[model samples]
Target: MADASLFEVDTDELRRVGNTMVGIGDDVAEVARTAPMDGRGEWGHQGLAGAGDRFGARYRYLIEQLAEDVDRGGVSLRGSANAYEEMDAINAASIAGLGMDW
Candidate 1:
């Protein structure tokens, strides 16, 4: 048995969660890309035009940043999963070379 104090990992779960995060990021990015940036004529008040533009720009920046952050998180998760799996394989190989039977 592994040491109780050591951390355990489920690589498949990590990959699954990573995929979900990537999909969510893609969805968020699509919305951010498609959303209208200019609300100049949409609002009845002329004073709202400037505010709308400013808000739109800020919203776009925030949404895009969120998408990028989420995407990077997913990538990081996948990388960790891959690293764990690779390490497991290497360990297995080393054990086999030692002719140790469990």
Candidate 2:
């Protein structure tokens, strides 16, 4: 798609993505809040930490999307696409502090 921004055809798709991300984030947070805690439960923080990890992942996706839209002055189409995946891989690598951290 020559001259296509990541959002050139349908900006609404991005909004849908964003809304989905927010909804998931909210769900995660709510679960963390309401879930029962163990005695002396520093482990309860794992749920909240997992939620933050999810939000960070969603934010990373948004950033990768914006990068695709940027074009970077004639980068190859495949290169542009690959960049986003690589960004995701890097983000996934850095995720931490989630119980088993899975």
Candidate 3:
């Protein structure tokens, strides 16, 4: 395993990735909003219609949950980038205070 101290983070890259994740989450949410899986009157048989409705409800619930989770992940990633950037700034300031150029 690589040493933790040697790890490097690209804040810009993190922000970009976070933004992409957010976009994907938004797209997923749009899908859930636009394509509701309510197969009530479509099925010919009553039993099949009921089953389809149940499945549709479950699918909508799961998709909504997934969208929320993904959005949270993206937000977390963006927050992490900000935290890392701040930490880097503090470290550089500390280094500069020691009569050194960082």
TM-score of each: 0.78, 0.29, 0.82
Scored against the true structure, residue 43 in model 1 reaches a CA lDDT of 78
Clashes of each: 0, 0, 0
- Stretches of candidate 2 off by over 4 Å are 1-9, 37-102
Residue 55 lDDT (model 3) = 78
Which is the winner by lDDT between candidate 2 and candidate 3? 3
lDDT of 2: 0.47
lDDT of 1 by residue, 1-102 (tens): 122112367877888899999999999998788656555778788778877878878888899999999999999998988887777667767777999642
* Candidate 1: residue pairs that collide: none
* Per-prediction CA RMSD (Å): 3.9, 20.9, 4.1
1-102, model 3: which lDDT tens digit per residue?
Answer: 111112378777778889998899988887777545454787688898888778777887888888989998898889988888777778778887999876
lDDT tens readout by residue for model 2, 23-96: 55555554444323223234368677676666656766665555444433224333444565455445445654
The CA lDDT of each predicted structure is: 0.79, 0.47, 0.76
Sum up the clashes in candidate 2.
0
Question: What is the lDDT, from 0 to 100, of the residue 76 in candidate 1?
Answer: 92
Best by lDDT: 1
Q: How accurate is candidate 1 locally (lDDT)?
A: 0.79
Q: lDDT ranking from best to worst? A: 1, 3, 2
